[model samples]
Target: MTTSFQKKTRSKVLQIPGAKPSIYNNQLLISTGIPSLDHILGGGVAVGTILLIEEDTYGNYARLMLKYFCAEAVMTGHSLLLASADADPEQILKELPAPIIDDPGKGEATLEEPSHDSSSDNMKIAWRYRHLPKFQSNTSGVKFGHYYDLSKTMESELTQTVDISTVDSSLCACDSKQTDGEFNNPGYNSLLKTIQEKIMANGFSTTTQVEKRNILRLALHSIGSPMWGEKGGLTENEMYSPALPRFLVGLKAILRTAYACCVITVPAHLFCDKAYVRRLERLTDTVVEVDSFVGSDKEKNPVYKDYHGLFNIKQLPCLNSLVCNMPDSLDLAFKLRRKKLTIEKLHLPPDLSETANRSQEDPLKNLKPSSGCGTGGRSNKLEF
Candidate 1:
């Protein structure tokens, strides 16, 4: 005569190292290796997305960012696949920046420092603003990213813990019988195939036989440059080639069904056609461009004297929802200090000092009248 009910149990999600659920949508995300960049990217990059970085004029800062990505993989016990045509992947791995560990003494020292402004302690806050929350660069409960010391190289023992695979496009041979079409370039074809194989063989795919699952971090450096045999945007006739775009399509397809993410740096400054660049931007999930002021006039200007380059966010993808994660502010700049590369909201130092001579001689009073001013003649100098 009695009725019984059974309790339904929910499935537990597996926790992966170096990965965390996004605060906004609960989607799995991985850090880009730089803490500030991860904050700018809205709690790190979402899994299975492509991050396209347009190389700066000198390609120095872009390359440094790529190194950070690899260093994070090493520290977090994630798999890494580095592909490049110009430089050896082994060499790149050897130059990863050392990870910085937090020290309790340093924190205590900072807290014990005296305040510089005496009146700041007595300043009053409005009632409405007092209840507002303080600003934070990272809002996640878990620490997903680590800070790196750019001046030091990672120790070899720590780097050895990571499983790494490298693909050198320079060593790949092209097929003589292949026709010109999608993935026409042999390097592109080989790179795409290598990525697919790595995903399947390493159990990074969704349907894998392996028991434990881990994320794969792929970094492709200086793609679409002359060394990759893509014409480097030298001529207008070759600007619209479908090779790079088609390759990206395949790469994106591979990432969607696998537990992998990619960061690719392209020499976008070489491409002359705006439409072709636009096409490339449309194919990627996230697009960021770096404009370095190394040898330009901005390097000498006091406004940007503290910054090495500008960080521009061109596109951000919406994952599992209608809205995308937008950063708090777009006016951002990056600078390299002695030990770290940091991205922060661009702000100029306050010029508090008054001008030495506020009142000066007027320009009109300094001008003298011409000799023929009264005869309706064109005078070179005149007085108002």
Candidate 2:
């Protein structure tokens, strides 16, 4: 007689708040805070990758994206590490947009009207396509992301709930010898070290087992700019420094085995060398660039009047697979609505106005047929 053996059950995956499994690769993802952006970036940014944002010309829109990132963290109860040389992290945290809480009563009241409108709208489309599922920019069912009110700052009481850390590059102690040895910039080295320290201290490292697991969102603002103690990469003749690239490598290494992710905004437009920018992009997991039309001729053009800027996705990471999640559409634009920033498929306004339409007279009809060209007309004989 042999002793009976009991089968062991598999441990359940830790369910972190504000995070969801990606549809593409089943990796856990956290929102970038902007729902449309989260949609563009598959379900959301993966927990252990670096997201590089190429800043818009004035750095305005890029900064706003960073704020959205941090605001999402605050709303979801994730820890934040905000680093910046140009602005105080405290001030940036104070400016985070407040989360929009939906009222159940209001939703129920309007549900009938929206349903009617939707049915009518579907009826307007072709019968073959009417039954097709509607495309949603954000993930459906699970509340993985939340809408934010750009006009309102997050309440003080709300911000105090999450653990927050800051790294002010300006105040960081710099050792010239240390800077020379690795990363090439004291500010970069300091920031990297701070991030690594925070990961270990907060039990975010993969090896650190804790009772509760949460994501660490690191937001670095305006890196590679002059304020970070490096030549801002604006001049054509300036040699490319390996500092930023090295820092990214170190950062990637730190994140690979940790329960954290990072969002970095670089003044990419300021970088004169295209190859240098490419090198930086190669180092990051995901790359997006904001091309704002603020000071350009596009601002005056009617075709782009509806959008403030173009949103370009240069790269996406392949997590746990050979193929990465690709967005349905590549042409996208961003605009600031009354209360929030929105990213949508780039579309031109209909040509209803006479200014955009062609003249009433057909140009082809107005052209007289050449008398000697057609068989109906006689051509003059050439002299031999």
* Candidate 1, residue 224: how far the Cα is off, in Å: 0.4
Model 2 ranges with Cα > 4 A deviation:
1-12, 103-142, 172-183, 234-237, 352-384
Model 1: per-residue Cα lDDT over 204-229, one tens digit each: 99888677889999999998887777
lDDT of 2 by residue, 1-384 (tens): 876887787445569998888878778899998877888888799999999999998999999999999988888999999998878888998898888787222453466667755775767547667656654343434466776777789998899999999887565445434455633677887788889999999999999999999999999999988777656543224566777888899999999999999999999877768888999999999999999999999999999998999999999999989988889888989998645577878987888865454668656543444544543323345411
Count the clashes in each prediction. 0, 0
List all candidate RMSDs to the true structure: 7.1, 5.7
* Candidate 2 accuracy as lDDT: 0.82
Q: Rate the local accuracy (lDDT) of all candidates.
A: 0.81, 0.82
Colliding residue pairs in candidate 1 = none
